[model samples]
Target: MIERGEDWVPPLPTGERVAGAKRRSGEGAAPTHPAKRKAGATERARELRLDETKAEYRLWGELRGRHLNDYKFVRQVPLGPFFADFLCREKSLIVEIDGSQHAESLTDESRTTWLNSHGYSVLRFWNHEVLAERRAVLDTILAVLEGQIHSPSPGLRFAPATLSPVGRGGGASHG
Candidate 1:
């Protein structure tokens, strides 16, 4: 039955199918095609999530695709089910911006741990540091890439003070 919402036009011949018909719907009826999964496709998906943060945006402009100093870095990096602010595949590094809200979330800790387990180093910068001390933050990232600052150890220590009170133990706070 041709419903009001369904396509009224006739279907294409079996052999005259469109190249993107199956891709747009994310259905894999046929054998997997390597060309459909390019090496940079993951990076491209991450790039779609960029937002306009004054500091983050500016940094992005400077370091987009590692344009700055020719050091390759991808913005809005997708890892697993989450997205990182920035990622360098070559160095297996991720840079994140942590706001006051982030200080209280166990989710960040879990995310960091997951990334670490996958051999990717995670560096988190406070929002204030990103805004007020942008250069220092960038410098720190560069230094890490330059092999000056050793990556965090396998067992990273999370300071209790940074965790949300409830995250530490108590129930969720109303405020």
Candidate 2:
């Protein structure tokens, strides 16, 4: 072992070093408290809003400024541990725009489960669908917000097939 001078100092832990680097680089440092985490999440949500995908931008155009049924929609909202694409606090609704990567994703399924358990109804739309069939997607969201679409009970698993806009016989169905 090498002897150290009286002014010698030990190296910082790995986590601290990384955090220090982030701070020095002007990147936001990791939050250290619950409140700080919440604030960080808010900032992250803001960043996501600014860097939204094309599909997200299109949807926001329709949803923002209370353009959809006079309902206010916020984009890139941070919920428990997830960032919702859009959220209507009044209706307890969350809208998620999924890309191809989300198909049959177990993580998405679990996320939907958690949101449902927390009394939030989640609506998922394919990115392509949002871009190509904007009207239909808006219609589906409107129907749900208007209570025209019946969602499954809290404990019951929600089936995407049940709420499909296509083949609806003028009435919503729950599965």
RMSD of each: 17.5, 14.9
lDDT of 1 by residue, 4-34 (tens): 2111112243433332343212332322221
Runs off by more than 4 Å, candidate 2: 1-39, 152-175
lDDT (CA) per prediction = 0.54, 0.63
Among all windows of ten consecutive residues in candidate 1, which has the lowest summed lDDT? 2-11
Model 2 C-alpha lDDT per residue in residues 1-175, reported as the tens digit of each score: 6853321222332212232333211344333221123446777777888888899999999999999989999888765556778987776678888888777554565456544544567888889999999999999899888888765534222222222222222233332
True-vs-predicted CA distance for residue 61, candidate 1, Å: 2.1
Give TM-scores for every candidate, taking all chains together and pairing residue i with residue i: 0.58, 0.65
Model 1: lDDT equals 0.54
